[model samples]
Target: MMELFFKDFIMLWSTIDPVGTLALFTGLTARLSKSQKRKVALKATTYAFVILLSALVLGQIILKAMSIQLISLQLAGGIILFLFGLQMIFSDPEEGTGSREPGHQLAVFPLAVPSIASPGAIMAVIVLTDNNMKTFTQQAMTAGAMTSVLLITCGLMLIADRIFRVIGHNGSAIIIRVMGMILAALSVELVMTALGVQRWMS
Candidate 1:
């Protein structure tokens, strides 16, 4: 049981990828003020928590009703992440401030969905909490592990916000472009893995 708990923690940590999410958060919230960035981080984390918890509890049923496979979700999410990555890469880091939506809306988008509570994270929770495979206690332990990871993710985002606060716009611009490339590569990996093309190619 203890070993399983440890495994779950590591699994969730990889799927959640708090550092990756932190990069996305920093890049997305670059235009906002310090206080706004804080609120966005908190809100994105809260939203991710709610989303992952819901997936743990009810995702299987919902997916079944929609006749959707986890791989399909992964494919779709990968496409979206790739597009967002391209946007982050090409668009001016300091542009879009005046015409764009508010910070709270950003908390719901690429930040919350594919960034923090990613498709991999969602699939992981659902699989970990499968009604047939796991007992209630085991599922509960998995949930606890996921929660711990999310807390860590949130902490990292907060710390990143502080770092960016010091570094200012120029530093933020460079990292955002770098993270965009990373995100694009990540999305491609997600797609290939979902398609089971990895073993075929390499």
Candidate 2:
């Protein structure tokens, strides 16, 4: 059980990538006040948790019923993430993103979706909790690991402002653009990997 928990922990941590999420959060919420930042962080983590837990519980059934392949999600998420990355890179530094972005909407989007409950995270949870392949006990352990990682993600985000302060206002824009470039490349890689997997499977 300990081994299973550790294995799933490593997998979940990599897929969730709390540090990456925190970096993205810092970028997106750069203009927000401390309270607003906290709210966004908490909301994003909660939404991500719900999304991922659902994927763990009913993902296979939903996929089968809808005749949806995981590749579709990968493609969609990659495209959306790539578009957002472009926005981040080119967005005006003088404009106030936090004021324009609704609390819930911002929390639900780029933050909760691709950054936290990412295509990779969703796929990882579903695969780890597969009803056909994993026993109930193993699935439970995986769930525990998932919860642990998410909690850590939430904690990191709660302190994201301090992290942002280190970068300072002047550097925030630069970091956002740099992270955006990296994010764009990552999204492209995700799409390519999904296509590669499809070809390999075929």
Candidate 3:
């Protein structure tokens, strides 16, 4: 049981990538006041938690109804994640700030979606808690691990001001680009695994 918990925790942490989220949060909320940044952080974390929790609970049912195989979902998720990573790598910082409204839009979009909950994150939870493979207790444990990660993410966001101060805008941008490249590579691996390319080669 402890081993399972540890495995789930590591998988959740990697998929969620709290550090990467912090970098993106710092960049996105660079212009907002402390109080406003707090609100955005809380909202973004709440939204991400709700999204992932829902996926954990209802995802398998929906997939069964839709007749979607796990491999198919993985492939689709990898494509989405790869595109999002590309955007993160190439997007102009000024464009992110100028295009979106400060408060609500910032919380809901790039921050909450691809940045926090993320395609990879969503797929991960679904796969981790697969009804056929894991017992209810195991799934519940996975949920707990996911919630812990999100809470930590929120905590980091709340301190994003300090992080930004330490790293500065340029530093944060560089880290975000680096993370994006890593994400793109991970997505490609996910795609390959889903297609059984690795298995075939082995």
lDDT of each: 0.86, 0.86, 0.84
Each candidate's TM vs. the true structure? 0.91, 0.91, 0.80
lDDT of 1 by residue, 122-141 (tens): 99999999998899999999
**Model 3 Cα lDDT, one tens digit per residue, 1-202:** 8888889999999989898888778766776778889999999999999999998999889988999876786687678768877987998856645444457777987678867887778888999998888999999999989998999999999988887778776786787688678769878998999899999999
| Candidate 2 lDDT by residue in tens digits, 96-137 | 454555465669988899889999899999988889899998
Best TM-score among the predictions, by candidate number: 1
In Å, residue 35's CA in model 1 sits off its true spot by: 1.4
Residue-level error in angstroms, candidate 2, position 113: 0.7
Q: Which residue pairs clash in candidate 3?
A: none
Query: What TM-score does candidate 1 reach?
Result: 0.91
Q: What is the Cα-based lDDT of residue 103 in candidate 2?
A: 60
Worst 10 residues of 3 by lDDT: 93-102
Question: Which candidate would rank higher by lDDT, 1 or 3?
Answer: 1
lDDT of 2 at 74: 85
Off by over 4 Å in 2: 93-102, 197-202
**1 or 3: which has the higher TM-score?**
1
What is the TM-score (0 to 1) of candidate 2?
0.91
